[model samples]
Target: MGEWIQSIADTYKAICAGEAPWVALGNFMNAWYDYAKDQREALVSESLPALATSSLEQRRWAAFCVASVEYLCQRYGLHCPDWVYQSQYSLVEPWFHAVNPHKPQVRARLIETTPEPFTRRNIYCGNKMFANKYEFAAQAGTTSPNQAI
Candidate 1:
């Protein structure tokens, strides 16, 4: 397998092995940014459905897997695979991507701010939850006074 594919597989394995969903998602997003455009398209159209389906069968982190894939697809303007739209991928209850001591107010705010892609899957997180370093750099551009010569 290609390195990008392997990296994504490793991230998925980590998620299945009990890594925190948000942390695994960060790792996944970083690896995703490294994928070439064709690879990214293939990943979304071919590979992600298997991973999401496996997570669903495992009955652990299924919502996170589906929502993360859909979120990435939406961000990049890719076509989300049909399996992601199945009823099984949607969580029966809302899952707030928060740590212990999850505050009710925080959950409320997340519910308010989470993007449609995630909210539809019943996965709630900050609107910027998927932002990565590459996105930050792109947004920063070269105009910052602090940029090195």
Candidate 2:
């Protein structure tokens, strides 16, 4: 896990240093995929800064990073802290769905700092859903049950 994170961090450094497109993107995506396979939640959270920095007109890659994080959070029962999600919206909005609706913080500074009226809801609730899903799975004793995660 440490090695994987180091590779990702190195990729971020390369991107910051203006590395070539293929090397930077390939390294980032490779590291991200490995982390996802390992179900490393903290690394997933930690990767956000690098991902935000590494998003260089590669909108699809940016979206990939976001979706990967969301999926891992769901898989591993890791809820992003609210403040962290708050920070990321300044970079880009995460993925969305019908059940989750945007919520704008009413604090004066929050409103002043962000002109956008809303941020994605459930930004931190994915892990709770994951845990519930796990518990349900445990109860069912099989993976085929009809349930939401």
> What is the per-residue lDDT of model 2 for residues 1-149, given as tens digits with 9 covering 90 to 100?
55545333354455456676447645544444443445444454455344444443443333333443455455557784333344443334443322333554333333333212132321222222223333465677866334534
- Please provide, for model 1 over 1-149, each residue's C-alpha lDDT reduced to its tens digit, 9 standing for 90 to 100: 36545333455566777787568766656557754445675655543324434644234366656676777888888887776677766777677876641898889888889888778877787687665656555567854323622
Local distance difference test values of all predictions, in order: 0.64, 0.42
Per candidate, the number of residue pairs that clash is 0, 0
- Where in model 1 is the C-alpha error above 4 Å? 4-10, 35-38, 47-60, 100-102, 142-149
Report the number of backbone clashes for model 2. Answer: 0
Error of 2 at 64 (Å): 7.6
Task: Candidate 2: list runs displaced more than 4 Å.
Answer: 4-11, 47-68, 71-78, 81-84, 91-149
TM-score of each: 0.71, 0.33
